[model samples]
Target: METILFFIIVGIISTIFGKSKRTQGQSPKKPIKVSGMEDIRTLFKELKNEVSLPAAPIKSEQKVEVLQKSNRTLEQEYNQVRKESESSRKALAASRLQREKMKEQTIEVSKDECEPSISMEPNAQTLVNGIIWAEILGEPRSKKPYFPKRG
Candidate 1:
């Protein structure tokens, strides 16, 4: 382990010294040449003239046509969405009315069934009362008294 560590330290030192020697022995490089102010001014003038040429008018006309087409499509989409929402609203109202009618019918049916029970004859009422008591007491029907068979 000690031998391996010694070789690693030696290798790092040799690389560091080698890079410093190579940089110190090299000559400095010359500065790069650049264009003067007149050349820059002429280039800027050419660019400005190209930007202000006939192609600008054609681009503006095309932009206008594109904007009109997009506006028409947006208007059509808005009208379609409005129609769909109106239809959904009508459907919702119809379902609400149907639910209310169903509730009224159920109420009427329950009331009719209750009226018959209230107006039942004495013998039938007594038999019903006995059956209800037997159910409450958990009595089996086989142990109950037999009734006359109905025609």
Candidate 2:
């Protein structure tokens, strides 16, 4: 509450002072000008005039020669990298093809190795005996005897 009252009093005082200053036709406070591109450009021009730097040591011919040498070296490096990339790509393709061939061979080997669990069908009696054994092992003996129906 005290803070609120203080803020209100300050606001009122500031407004009163502002009105008085305005009515006087001339304000004591001057309008501030924001710095713009033109101001920055003028400042830059003035700074350039005040501070002078020594000229570069290299002549135009030397600069051109250096630039040409650097360009040639850069082009050579680019071609070398391109050749290396192409060779690596070819190696990758070869490895992929080898991997694919190995996979195919593995699949063929697995097919050749696998054999069916039961090659021949069991006789009817053998099947019945198997069913009876399965029932005996799988379930508990009940009050009524269990028997498999004929197919």
User: Which candidate number maximizes TM-score?
Assistant: 2
What lDDT, from 0 to 1, does candidate 2 have?
0.86
Tens digits of per-residue lDDT for model 2, 56-100:
566899989999999999999999999999999999999999999
The reply for model 1, stretches above 4 Å from the true place, is 1-58, 117-151
Candidate 2 displacement at residue 76 in angstroms = 2.9
The global C-alpha lDDT for each of the candidates, from Candidate 1 onward, is 0.85, 0.86
Q: After superposition, how far is residue 104 of candidate 2 from its true place, in Å?
A: 1.5
In the range 1-151, model 1's lDDT, one tens digit per residue, is 9999999999999999988987887534644336656788889999999987855466778889999999999999999999999999999999999999999999999899888554455787688988988888887766675985678
Cα misplacement distance, residue 13 of candidate 2 (Å): 31
C-alpha lDDT of candidate 1 relative to the true structure: 0.85
